[model samples]
Target: MFKSKLFDSIGFIRTTFLIAFFILIFLASITYRHIKELDKISYSIMNTYEVSLELNQLISYIKDAETGHRGYVITNDSIYLEPFIDARENINKSFQSLSSRIDLDTVKQKQLSRIYDLVDKRFYYFKNNFSSKTEFNNDFRNGRIVMDALRKEVNKMLRNENKLLSSKDRLYRYNNSNTPLIIFSTFLISILTLGYGYMRVIKNYKDLMNQNIRLKIFDESSKQAEILGKYGSWVYSIENKTFDYSDNKFRLMGCEPQSFLPNSDNLLDNIHPDDREIIINAFKDIEIAETFPLLRYRIIKKDTLEIRHFKTAAKFFTDRLGNKNMIGTTQDITEDFNKTQLIKLRNKELEQNNKELTEFNHVASHDLQEPLRKIQTFISRIEDKEKENLAETTKAYFEKIQEASNRMRILIDDLLQYSRTNRSEKKFELTDLNTIANNAISELSESIKEKNAQITFKKLHEVNGIPFQLEQLFINIISNSLKYSKPEIPAVIAITSTKTKAYEKPKLKDNSKREYIKITFKDNGLGFEQKYAKKIFLLFNRLYGKNEFPGTGVGLAICKKIVENHKGYIFAKGKPNEGAIFEIYLPV
Candidate 1:
């Protein structure tokens, strides 16, 4: 748009300048005839033969000044201002011409000197800083005043001859009357148009510069990100059949950037011998399918002689010119691939270990318990058959043996339950907590009755979890509370559930975008010291002696394991003699 406007302005200026030139030409010709007639008429009246010619020459210089001023106004060009300067210089020529007449020219010299001084006065205003419209207007008005002064000076030079000259000069004067004002109006319009265009150009240039800077910054930032992330990008032009690689792309191939030009052959050379066909098919696929599907392949590093993993994804792009290009990124995933393989090996080892542990669990549950049962059976037989003959100490030792066997049986049972919790085949089903809690209460009905415990629950939330494991969780926690209940006070276990977000509970540790069912079991039991809250959940971790609390020290550990299986968390909060709260958070 700026270029078009500039061309239009140049064209307008050319037309105006040409029109001014012709107008000046037409005025000059008329003025020339008028001067010729005045010269003849004056010679007959006075002996001033060179007077008319000198005066006509002066008129031509004035015409040059007008044309210069008009051009300067129309074009707003410094080049046009040169004519004003030229007029100033050429006025001296007019003075010199009128001076060397060698006729009785004392009066002419005085009058000519006054004209020269008036010309100087005319240019004085212009010579000052005159770029603005107001300055131009003032200079133009001064020019008209000087023109009048100069004409008056000319008339005074030959008073009697002027009467004949004035009659002929009137036609020339009338012809050029409105030229200066018309030219000045064109000058103002031209200045306004040019100023507006210049401002728009500056504004556009600034906007373009800002966009370019942002693009360059983005390019640099993307390059840095690729380097830090161990990735590289490449572009393939279908029209040119050429390959262009980012700097990091060359580095990934174990060479300095641009050390080797990227082409299909060179790219294939970097690929592992076993995986080279995969890359060959990738390049072929761009044209065959017009798309490159995801490809995970291996490349052999030239420097390290080690295989590195690479995965590429690309899409076909047609630019504004309809040139097809395939742009893709390949990342160095050696670390991630190796870690994944290591995890698979570790998982296999764990599976084998779990199988052995399951076998051990069977042995502990039955094989080991068989011998213990027999020992208990032998003791029972001795007490029934020879009770009178046995000593009191001997009877006491037998009773102690019975208690040890019972404790051992309890230990084996608890260990077996813990092993099942560790099993990985946990199938999740949406289990209602209200039903689970009621089931736990019914199962422990005898214990609840004996302990005179109150197990109250309401508004228990539901969650997707293993039904059997969740049941075991509720049973173990309730049993634990009953076992620790204060002797003087009836046990009060209140189970309640509320909906909550993960971040709301910092103890959950994982601030994911998930909703959790916070099932809290608050019990008025003989709670332990707050310091042992975390320690109480470990395997065989007992806060009190076996006589104080008859437990295998493994029930809470099993509860933690079961909660973890359901992708949940449990925390134990306690106060000495006050109460204990077991918080179980399962994802909803």
Candidate 2:
């Protein structure tokens, strides 16, 4: 956010400076024009004064000629004639100068023409009267009249010149007074604009400084996370064709950070020889590919010279400047890879051991049960035919042998069943619990009757399962209840079913939203302590000794295995001397 705002502020400052620059240019242009106007007005004022001065000079020369002529007319002096003769040439020169000055002004030029005519008539009197005595008095009177007329005309021209001079002076004063304020206002506006731009720049600079500090802290934290996680990140910029390796990236190669530049060749040098071609081919399409697929290979650490497994994956994205880049992380998976291989090897060995054990059990079961059957057959014949001759003590020993043989036969049969249950290749079919429960009850009908036990159930749920296994599960659970029943009270077993969600039963500890058919078996038998609920389902985990309980401890274990085979869960709950409950959940 700060970076974006900073860019906006920079653009604003540039625009402000641009506006200020144009204002400066405008101010210069206006000031220069104002100066030119003022200069023109000043020149006009000077010309007005010069024209007035020339008119006054012309009058002075005519007056000098009149004064000298008067002196010569009374005393007849030749020096007076010299003054009169010089005044004529001086008056003509003054008239020429005044006409040139007022030529562009029509009104002023007409007035100057009248003054020139008056002067010419006065000069004609001076020459005409000097040659005739009778007309000399009249000529002198006429010359004096012309001289007075010339003075009046010259004074009129002077008044007009003075009026023009006053007009030009007022205009010059007005322009001179306004120019300074106009220029000053423009300069001040430019200064204020620059000041605002400077303040904005300062504020953005401080914001950028704070943001930079935060970014540096974030970068450091990311580096630490990479190092601790045994992973390293790298970036490939397609536009620049450049690579950037994080500090941990170099460390992953067992080299110090930035020990060498990041590039394809340097990275490939650390890869195992057999995997080098794979890594090389993967990168060859990096420029055109949108992403890098997950790749696992082996690399030789530079410092340790040890081969370690590594896996890398990356996705391609375009930066704000439209530069294509791919960022990927490479992890040191040597420990995980070795553990995975070990598990695979152990799994193979365990599978082989189980197979051999199953074959042996198959062979040994037939051999062992045959001998036990033969022993039972021989013992029964002895007991039947030689009972009368046998001593009571001998009969008691024979009974003990018979009991031992029966227990051994049951144990051997249970072991074989367990081995078959452990095989994963058993075929599954849609099986109904109602039918399985009825079949199991019928099979154990003799024992149920002997214990006066009631095996009751409603319509149970159907499931995809191994049919024989389900029947076996029911038979074992019912027999267990019958065996553990209190001698005072008849055993009562209830099988019930309901549909429920997995999360509804906390003991199931599953969070799936799928529905399950829960089948519960409640028995009013000598249930063990609640603490031993989970232990009862483990193989060979019997609560009572063999002398007290006739069970081989494999019944509930087989039940648990069958439930698991159908992707179901089995849980047991018990209360001492009260009853036990087994709940099984199977997917619908």
Candidate 3:
């Protein structure tokens, strides 16, 4: 019965294989014919491209020649005659090039020859008329006739070429229409072949009942272990001398199951030399005592020679027939190991960098403050002691120095604030942004009063933020609005906020929670060009001169730093002469 069943299966497989072979033959024939058609189409396209290029060159040459001829006729300048002469000399070459590319059809060839003859005749008449000092009107009339005839012949050739191109394009469309049918047929054949293969597997399982029963328990347990550990198993039979590998087991070894089989000797050979002995001893212990069901080691990939860490556990099991089988699983731990090492190295480097930056900022800021203090002190002394005795120009110079010193002081303070923002720990809480905006407005009351600015506030939302930093951000932005107000209009400052639900807070290193707050600060000020919107955030960037707007350009820079420290972003939008709007997005 078994022999008869085997013969039946063989016959079935043979029939299916024959069907597959015939399908492959059909596919190959279609592909071959398609390739030939494609080659012809490609040649036709290249010829068309060449012909078009030649025609364009000819047109350009004719236009240049006509321009030069007209200039020489009007101005009687010999210099203008050079281009005409050069074009006349090159005209024959262009005609020859076009003639060479024309199709070998008699009509097309004859048309090209006629065009060439007419162009030659026109050139000869032009040259003779110019040399003999013939009347311009007669020469022009004859030249027009010859050019017209030549143009007619060229147009005829172009029509024939375009017809041929259209035919080729239709052929391409016809071939494309057949492609979908061919692809569908190929896919159908593939699906039928795969179904046949699946059926064969099922039949084999049914016929090999005893062997299947023995493997059933082992396969299920191996699969369970693999899923639990993100691993897979393999086995090498000593007596039968056959190798078996699971799908994931082959993947862990960086090999295909059909290409490489797992074996004791092959596995050992692929292991890192330093880890080989360790794995061998572990395997031996498991085999001898049958006590442990797990072993772990590192192996090197054959292609990359990179060490891949692995952990495996296995046991020897005997069937009812006393056949011994070894089963084991391997887990790849290379990624986990590498990630741990990377974390350690990065943490060390970051700690060292943080220490260096902290010291640098402290020393740099302290050193810069001393010189600024001396300048301020000297300027104050000059104004207090020598005001009346000094000349007007000298006094003006002293005032300028004092203004500069004051600006420098503000810059230094802003710089310190910006640097401190980077190091300050955020203390997030529900804070009223309306109160913050009011406080900033109150702080700038003197400037607002001087400028006669009309400031308005809408109901602002309470958002999650560091209160002090939020307050500082509000002050800088509001102060900027007052400073750059339009000369003609009262500065109109509007403050408003809206809750944003869709906003995502940027993740911190510790993976903390965040929220979002949307605030808009609009001002009717001497607005800048839109291009300067982003640039205004950079330190020391000023759109207007100090005489026009007086402030250290660090205000926006500080606002940007503070917003970023609070896990937020600020963007400006404005057009020349229009009002500026600053949008701030804060994460709660």
Off by over 4 Å in 3: 1-308, 311-329, 339-355, 386-394, 501-515
How close to the true structure is residue 125 of candidate 1, measured as C-alpha lDDT? 50
Stronger candidate by TM-score (1 vs 2)? 2
lDDT of each: 0.80, 0.85, 0.76
Which residue pairs clash within candidate 1? 73-187
Task: Give per-residue CA lDDT, model 1, range 305-338, as digits (tens).
Answer: 8899998988889887889998989899989999
- Top TM-score: which candidate number? 2
- Which ten residues in a row are the worst by lDDT in model 1? 40-49
Error of 2 at 404 (Å): 4.4
Error of 3 at 14 (Å): 34
The best candidate in terms of lDDT: 2
| Number of the candidate with higher lDDT, 1 or 2 | 2
Q: What tens digits encode model 2's per-residue C-alpha lDDT throughout 1-588?
A: 756777888899999999999999989898788878777877876777788787788888888888888778777777888777898889888878877877898988888888888988887776523656758888888988998888788888778777877787787777578768878998998999999998998887787788888889999998889988889999988776667889998898889998888776566888999998878878887777675778999999899999999999887888988889988899989899999999999999999998888888777876788888999899889889997797999989988998999899898888778777776477888889999999999999999999998888998888878889889888888888888888898889999999999888877788878788898889988888989989999998899998887878889898888888888998888998899998888887
Q: Clashing residue pairs, candidate 3?
A: 294-313, 295-312, 515-588
- What are the TM-scores, per candidate, against the unseen true structure? 0.60, 0.77, 0.47
Inter-residue clash pairs, candidate 2: none
